[model samples]
Target: MIEIESVTKSYGDVRVLDDVSLTIPTGGITSLVGANGAGKSTLLSVAARLVPADGGRVRVDGMDVATAPGPVLARRLGVLRQENAMSVRLTVRELVAFGRFPHSGGRLTAEDHRLVDEAMAWFELGPLADRHLDQLSGGQRQRAYVAMVMCQGTDHVLLDEPLNNLDMRHAVQMMRMLRGMADELGRTVVLVVHDVNVASCYSDRIVAMREGRLVAEGPTAELMTPELLRKVFDVEVEVHELAGRRIGVPWS
Candidate 1:
């Protein structure tokens, strides 16, 4: 479990995350939904120790995120940021191998190589494994990046906008893959998502944030409502139950 105690972050005079506190459960998919500048990325970066919180602390499974050793924390947690700008000219396989550095320390054993290959295969990157990132399409590159993160073999995975730039088919495929990761591999997946309907249909829990604070957090059916949608996104939406799933249709 990831425990956050009064985590706060700021940029000069502007506070991005206000005295926020929340516990992310051990397994299953949890989606973070919020509008632009709602502190979603900031919170994920703080949790992953990519950014320092101005106040409070974050703990992953018992180790303090701020003080934990880099390799130790990397072995237990993997984070995919919103932007991945790689300057080096590296093949997809080489990029995914970087995730094993914590365990392999730049020396990949047979087992490490096997894991990397498995991740590449899991994300359907077998054909693109030798291709460089710049050579692939946006969706293909996204899948390669996701494979890299999965190659970390961490119990906790944090993805900021995993579905960015993906078409409907790819988006649905990614969601299904995440579900399999949680249900089959028992990994805890948390993602910052823009589409509330996707959040409603896939996530086990939905965390709604606004103005740097968490406004609501609960099961999809309970937390997803017309009033909640209006309050969170400031848009009137219709909620429907189709095929035992709660979906939202924003009123345009």
Candidate 2:
């Protein structure tokens, strides 16, 4: 479980996360949703230790994230930030292989190679394995990055904007893959996403933030109401049931 205790952060005089406390249980997918500046991404970053919090603490699976050793924490938690950029050019296979560095220390063993191959095949990247990152489309690159994170073989995966540049089909595929990861592999998946409908459909729980404060959190079905969405996004939303799921439509 990920325990966030009254975490706070600030940028100059503006607060990005305001004493936000949340518990993300293990073995399922939880999505953070809100407007652009609602602190969803900031909260995720803090929990992943990509950014330090101004106050409070975060614990992952009973280990203090702030005090845990780098390699030890890396072994348990894997994170993928929104902007993935590399200064050096690398093939898709090389990028995926980098995920094993914590376990392999830059010298990949046979088991590492096997995991890399499995990750590439799982994401349907076998055809593009030899291609450089610059050579792939945005959606394909996003998938490759996610595959690298998954290849880390961690129990917890935290992703920021995982669906940023995908078309509808690939977006659906990505969510399905994440769902499979949680259901079959028993990994805890937490992501910052913009689309409420996507969160509604794929997430086991929904966390809503507004103005740097956590305003709502509950099971997917309970949090998908139009009132909660409007509270989070400050827009009129019409929520309807579609194919056994709740989908929200926003209006100006």
Off by over 4 Å in 1: none
> Lowest summed lDDT over 10 consecutive residues: which window, candidate 1?
243-252
Report the C-alpha lDDT of model 1 over 14-108, residue by residue, as the tens digit. 99999889999999999999889889999999999999999999999999999999999999999999899888988999999998998989999
Worst 10 residues of 2 by lDDT: 243-252
- Per-residue lDDT, model 1, residue 136, is 90
Itemize residue pairs with steric clashes in candidate 2: none
Instruction: Provide backbone clash counts, one per model.
Output: 0, 0
Clashes of 2: 0
lDDT of 2: 0.94
Q: Give the TM-scores of the predictions, in the order they appear.
A: 0.98, 0.98
